[model samples]
Structures are given as structure tokens and as C-alpha cells.
Target chain A: MMLPGFPDAAPLAGLGGGILIGLAAALMLLGAGRIAGVSGIASRALGISDSGMSKSSAWMFIIGLPLGAFIVAVWSGGLDAKFAGTGALIAAGLLVGIGTRLGSGCTSGHGVCGVSRLSQRSVVATVTFMAAGIATVAIMNAMGLEVLQ
Target chain B: MIARYLPPLLSGTLFGGGLALGGMTNPARVRGFLDIFGNWDPTLAFVMGGAVIVMAIAWRIQARLAHPLFAPKFALPTRTDLTPKLIGGSALFGIGWGVAGLCPGPAVAALVIEPASAATFVAAMIAGMGIVRLIEKD
Candidate 1:
């Protein structure tokens, strides 16, 4: 089913995917007793951060991410993606890395896990990031910076 | 060892697959969702909503569990203070997310799908993280 005004929106697919993500996170929490936050996991895997999980275990999870995506891409024909120019990507990546570290989480950690549990910090962080993202996009659009191709 | 490692591997796979299937692997789609003022797409809201709903149930379940089935304990975050670092870092992350329409999860998931671009982003992101580490050391 399509959204009334947003013809491009795939609500069902989004919901299905969301459910799958939720299950993935649930598995992490219930099975391993961890929050499946990609940024934190990546840091731990790289030995940049300390965590209860082993480095090898962290690598396994990180590696599994692309493996799963590859499976879906293969089964679904292919995945389509677009990215900004190298300069923008580098700048953005830097900001993301630093910000997530300082903030202590990213979308998966704070947005999903934190928000679901009604954690005050996560809620505030989510709102702040959302607002910032919206504002950034708006400002970029105003300036005619066509980063998305 | 298998028991210790398998769960996270499975979790990551499911998470990555969900990201791909949810249309989040596509940067344009993510940017579209963020483009609230322009031609906005609400697909991400559904994804977030669905994930949050399921996770909310998981949290409820967590309250009753003595420990994680595979691990010794649940190592969740406990800090509650709202600090400048949190707000500033999140805001910076938001700007970056808006700039590229890619977050860590999708960026990592896209490693196989868009090798060159994803690699570039990931490499830069790692460097960004390194910068934070350096600054924190001072």
C-alpha cells in the first residue's frame, strides 16, 4: 500500500524492514544482552573503545552486516544506492564518527533501543539529531547544494 | 565460542538485511526522508515506528529476564545526564547524516553493494572517530 500524499513512500516495505531490524535488535538484546548499535560495535571492533564483547566477536557482528545485505541484494536482484561526492562523504563521515562517539550512540543505539525503553537521553538525542538533520537539509537546499545525485 | 559469537553475527545479519529490505540502503531514499521541506518521503518513519514497536516489547521482556540467554548479563547504558557533548555530537551527526544520507549502519551494510563509495565513507568515518580519540586524549 502507498501513502496518500507520499506516492513514493513504501510503507509496507518499510514496516516489514523495520520489523526485521527490530527482531535483529531483539536478538542482540535477549540473546547476547547487547544493544546492536553499529557505531559502537565498529569502534569496539577497531579497538578504539572498550566493551565486554571480544574484538573477534565484534568483527563477526560487523562482518555479518554486509553479509546479510549481500544476501538481500542478491535475492532482491540488486540494491540501488546513491552517495554524495567524495568531499561531502568524507566531511559527513567525519562528523558522524565524532558525533556518535561524543553522543555515545547513533540511530540504532539511541533511536531504536534507547527510544523504545523510554530513556530520557535517547529521546533528547533523537530529537536533537532529527532537528539537526532537517535543518541541515533545509539549509543545503536553500543554498542549492545538490549533494544527492 | 560458537554460542558466544553466533548471536551477534545473526543479529548483525538480520539488522543489515532489514536495512537493505527497508530501502534504507539507498542514500537517496534516506535523503528523501530527511528532506522534509522538499519532496519528503515518509517511508523511514514507518521503519522507525515498526522497529521501535518491536523493541518496546523486547524491553518489556528484558525486565523479567535474569540475564541474556547467551551472555552473562545485559550491558546496557546507564548514564542519564543530558550533557553538551551529547547535544553537540548528535547535532554534528545529524548534519553529517543530512549531508550524505548515510548513517553507520547503512554505510556498513552498503560495503558490498556500493564498494567504492561505502569504503570512502567508512574510511573517512573511522578517521573522524580517530580525531575524537586524539582530542579526548588531550
Candidate 2:
């Protein structure tokens, strides 16, 4: 199952990592008064021009996320990317920015938060957005769009 | 005995393993997948599908709980409007995923292995959230 994306492994790790985050977010919401929404916290901080306490906590959440895998890597090891080039990374970032903007939430928000709550709307958003994501990758692949060497 | 936190832990580990197995854990793999119309890696759907299967389980179990582990009930978003924020953010997310193959959770998680750029991706993502939150004005 994992072999499919042999060349890259981060997203595979990411999927596993994302589940933890989602579960944590769900538990955070269920156990605490928080919403488990990163944007909400970041947005609030951005509002005050202050990444304040919440901002720090949010960072901790994001930062600590990899700590698990980091711990795993400490004992074992991990793979690395050669980079298709700078242009490619930049373009990819821009595309994600657009998706986050359009999706009203990131994968975490919609995929985790929205979907967890069993929101019908979130259901549509997740399906639609994810489908679009698939399509985007397909198109990019078909175009033979390569990172400028 | 104290198995309450077990579910999250187990689920999380499985999720991580899924990522590692699917290659979603790697940024470059994501880029290649998104290099659509070119590389057009369809492996992503499998990753998403597998994760969604877990997601479905989470949803089902959610109903069984008398009360969620944290909140009185599931904390679904109150905002229902398909405001520009919704559509626009999604579009931006799609484009970024298509181009860079970096998404929020994984990008942050990717920080562990590929320290440099993953950090940058996360920073921009955080900044984007901050900026949007500010302009929305409550």
C-alpha cells in the first residue's frame, strides 16, 4: 500500500501524522474548550498583530507534531528529497495558498475539524476540495510541468 | 484502566504509518503528485481514501460516545455561509497542493525530516491565517 509513492514518503508520513493531529484536535475539542482550528488561533493572533500565548501554543502544536516522527527517526532514520528545483516548490506553495483560500479551511480544518463534527457542509467541502486537489495534480502531471532545472 | 487517551494515540500512530506508507510523508513526492498534467501522480487518492476510511470510523465512534472526550458534544463549526473565505481559501489550498504539494498538517509535520523549507511553508501558512484573521475583523 505504501509502496505506491515510493519516490516520496512525506505525505505518507503526513497522513499518519495528520490522523494524530486530527485525533488530537478532536480530543482537544472534546476534552478542552478549544476548537482545534489552527486558522482560528492564528487568525486571532494575526488580529492583534500578536502571536501571543495562543500563537505560541499553536506553534507548539505544529512544532510538537513532528516531534513524534522525529523521535522515531532518532532511533531509526528517514528519507530526504532532492528537490525538483526552487521554482517548483514556490509554485506549489502558491497553489496551496489558493486552495486554503478557496477551501475556507485547510486539510486539517476541513478534513479533520469540519468532517469530525459530521457537518454536511464540511462533507461537501472535503469531497469537493479533495477532488479538486486530485484534478490539480492530474493536470499538472499531464502538462509535463517540470521544475526548472 | 486509563484507556481514554488510547484511541487518539492508536489512531494517530496508524495515521502516521499510513502517511509513511503512502509517501505522503515526503514533500517531494507530494510535489511530483501535484505536478499534474505532467507526473499526475494519482497515488494521492489512495492516501486520501485510506485516511477517509479512518475518518469515517472516527465519525461513527463519535456518535457512540455519550459525550466527546473533551467537549459536551462535537464542536462543529457554527459558520454556515459559503463566504468568500470558504471558497477562496479552498481554491488557494487546491492551487498550492497542486503546485507545491504541501498542505498544512503535513507541511508542519514535514518540519521534522526536511527542516528548512517545511519550516518556511509552515510560516507562510501561519502568516496567511494571521492576516486573514485580522482582516476579517471578528
Candidate 3:
């Protein structure tokens, strides 16, 4: 189904995808006894950070992320996506890396896993990010800066 | 050894598939969701809602289990303190996310979907993480 203002929005796909993500996270939590926080895993894998999970385990999970995407691509016939310019991508990436590490989580860790478990910090983090994201978009639009192509 | 790695591999695959199907890997769609005051899309809300509902059930199951299926003990966060660092960092992350509409999960997944762009973002993000690691040590 399409959203009111957004013609390209795919609610069914979003819901289906979300359920898959939830199941994956739940599997991680129940099977591995850990949170599927990508940034934490990535850092640990890269030797930049050391969390409780072993680096090998971290690498295993990290590898799975792209592999999973590949399966979907083959099944669904790939995505037609565009990215920001190199400079913008680099700038944004740097912020995301630092911010997620400092904040202790991101969309999956905080938004999906945290809120579901009713963790106060996760809830607060999720709200803060949402608010900030909205404000940033608003300001950028006002300035007539189209970051996305 | 296989058990140690297999679960996460499967989970990661599922997670990646979800990101792609949900359109989270698409930067424009993500930016559109962030554009709350503009032509906002509620699709992300549905994605979050679906995942949260399933995860809520998982939490309940987690509470009942003695230990995880493949692990000795649950390795989850226990900190509850609200700190300036947390808020400030999250705010920074939000801005970055808004600017590029890509986060760690989608960015990693995008490595295969859109190699060059994803690689660029990943490399920069890792550098940023390295810088933070240095700052924390000092």
C-alpha cells in the first residue's frame, strides 16, 4: 500500500522486511545470546573495539549481512538504488561511525531491539535520533539542499 | 566451532534481506522517511512496527529461557544511565543518517547492492570509528 503523500512508499514490503529483521534479531538474541548491533559487531571485527563477543563470531555475523542481501538481490532481481556523492557519503559515514559507537547503538540495536524490550535508554535514544533526523531533514529542505539523488 | 558461527551467519542473512525488502537500503526512501515535514513516508514506521512486535515476543521468550540455544549466557546491555555522551552521539548519528540516509546495517548490505558507494561509506565509517577509539583512549 502507498502512503498518502509518498507515492513510492511500500508499506507491505516494509512490514515484511521488518518482520524478517525482527526474526533475525530474535534469532541472534535467542541463539547467540546477544544483541545484533551491527556497529558493535563491525568495530569488534575490525579490531577497533572489543566487545564481549569474540572477533571470529563478529566476523561471521558481519559476513552474513552482505550475504543475506545478495540472496535477496538474486531472488527479487536486484535494487535500483542511488547513493549520495562521494564527499557526502564520506562525511555521513564518518559521523555514523563515531555517533553509533558513542551512542552505543543505532537503528537495529536501539530502534528494533531496544524498544521491543522496553529498555528506557533505547527508547530515549530512538526518540532522540528520530527527532534529530526530522530536524536535519527539515533544515536541509528549507535550505534547498537535496542530499539524496 | 560451526555452531558458534552459523547462527549469526543465518541471522545476518535474514537481517540483510529484511533491509533490502523494506527499502531501507535505498537512500532516497530513507531520506524520504526522515523528511517528516516534507513529503514524508510512513513506510518506515510500518517496518519498525513489524520488527518491534516480533521482537517483543522474542523478549518474552528470552525472559523464560535459562540461556540462549547456542551460547552459555545472555550477553546483553545492562546499563540504564542517561548520559550526555549518549544524547550527543545519537544526535550526531541522526544528522549523519539524515544527510545520507544510510546506517551501519544498510551500508554494509549495500556493499553488494551498490559496491563503489557502499565501499566508500564503509571505509570512511571505519576511519571515523578509529578516530573515536583514539579519542577515548586519550
Candidate 4:
């Protein structure tokens, strides 16, 4: 179907973006011998240092994500960013932390790398994760929590 | 390995600030942006444009770097095609993004900037991932 954002793009841009993500992930694996899996990297950053190799790489990867995001904020220019409140952000962070632990990977891991590799796990995880996101938003919207509104 | 992260660090910070500017740091803002045409929020497009531009620059820089800080070069995928998996996963992702206004990357980014919904979204996202993994085993 048609996606709301980039309605003109339809399948082309998303698919193109997906391909690029896959390409980047694959390159990381081949060149640096990394998975480009954000979850593993992020989780390891918090803990789970079975080996220094996995742990260190994970930390860098986790750090890279926000770093990339921060640079984007400044270059684009915006009036100071705002948020719902401290409670929500912290609660959200904890949930995400736990979720990554239980899931074994996040969207980057399963959605990007796992899907790229055609791993069955990625397929299932991606669908489930995405669906959950949809469901959560719907319920939250209905509950009148109305974030961003 | 540590050296390899230098690029990501440089890129990630830029990405973060851009998200803040694009309002991606706010899921509500992103959701509103997606509601464009419905209400005409052209804000997200700028973020998309900005990001695409940054990506273009990174692509060029990476290509020129002889040593890429820690590796020879990026590895690309061998397969040059798509399958049922691509279609299904993308469809699911689209619905999620439409509803929550947070894709995985931005969702994680929002988490960092501190949003309550992002945390819930990520939690549900992980639970969803776990369930999928279990089913796949069977």
C-alpha cells in the first residue's frame, strides 16, 4: 500500500533505504567483521561483557547511534528541543532496555540485518516488533495519553 | 575495533542534532509530520532531506578514506534482489511508523533524547521481537 510519509516515494525509497541499510550492515561484517546489529551492541554497552571484543564493539555501536542523531540536530537547526517530562523519558528508557534484553535484538538487528540476511528470526521479529509498535500507539492514542499532541 | 567507531561517532552526533532539528527527537512531532497532506506538516521532509544529504556526504568521505579508520572497506550484500520477507517486513514497518511515528532508528534516537512513549514503544517493540523469535524456533 501507500505510505503516508513520502507518499510519492511508495516502495522505491523505503526499499532503497532498506537496501542501503543492508549494504552498510554487510560491509561492516565483511570489512570490520561486525554485525551492525544495534541491539547486541546497545545491550552490551550496558553490560553482558562475555568477552572484551563483543563488549567494546557493542559500546561503540551504541554510542554511534546517538552521536549520529546529535550531529543531525545541530546541522538542521531547530529552536531548542522539548520533551513530555522526565518521568516518561526515564520510564521509556527502562522499557527499551528491558525489551532489547528479552528480544535479543532491536529493529536494527532484526529489521535491518536479520531481514537483509533473510534470517527467519528477523522476519518474525520484524513483523512482531512493528505490529507491537502500531498497537501501542493506537492504545496510547485512545487512552488519551496523547503524547506529541 | 575502537578505531572503527570513529566514523560512527562523528556521524551519530550529527545524526542526533539533526533529529532534534527535524523534530524526530519527538515522536509526537514526527507523528504530526507524517499526518501531512492530512494537515500539511512539511517539517519531516526537511529532516529527510537533511539526512539524505548527510548520508551522501558520508558516502563520499568513506569512499575516499584509504583506511576507513579501522577497516579496508564496507562489505556489500551478495544478493541483488528481494523476496517475500522484504515485502512483509517493510509493510509491517510502515504501519508501525504511521501509527507510532517512530521507526526503529528514530525510536532509539528518541529514547536517547528522552521520551516516555519511545520507551513504551521500544518495550513493546522488543516484546514483539521476542515473541517472533520464539515462534520462529517452532
Best by lDDT: 1
Clashing residue pairs, backbone N/CA/C < 3 A, model 3:
none
B4-106: candidate 1 lDDT, tens digit per residue: 7788899999999999989998988988999999999999999999999999999999999999998888888898999999999999999999999999999
Q: What value of lDDT does candidate 4 attain over all alpha carbons?
A: 0.50
Query: Looking at candidate 4, what TM-score does chain B attain?
Result: 0.76
- Between the candidate structures 3 and 4, which one is better when assessed by TM-score? 3
**What is the clash count of model 1?**
0
Candidate 3 lDDT, A76-135, residue by residue in tens: 997868799998899999999999989999999999999999998899889988888889
For candidate 1, list the clashing residue pairs, or say none.
none
lDDT of 1 by residue, A1-149 (tens): 97999999999989998998999999999988888889999999998887657788789889988988999999999977888889999999999999999988899999999999999999999999999998999899999999865
Choose 2 or 3, whichever is better by lDDT: 3
- Residue B67 C-alpha lDDT in model 1: 100
Clash totals in order: 0, 76, 0, 28
Task: Name the better of 1 and 2 by TM-score.
Answer: 1
Q: List runs of model 3 lying over 4 Å from the truth.
A: A3-5
Fraction of the native A-B contacts that model 3 recovers? 0.84
lDDT tens digits by residue: candidate 4, B16-103: 4434444555656555555533343445554444334433444455456554345555543334344544444444554455454665
> Tens digit of lDDT per residue, candidate 4, span A86-106?
444434444444455445555
Model 4 chain B is weakest, by summed lDDT over 10 consecutive residues, at B10-19
DockQ of 4: 0.14
The 10-residue segment of model 1 chain B with minimum total lDDT is: B1-10
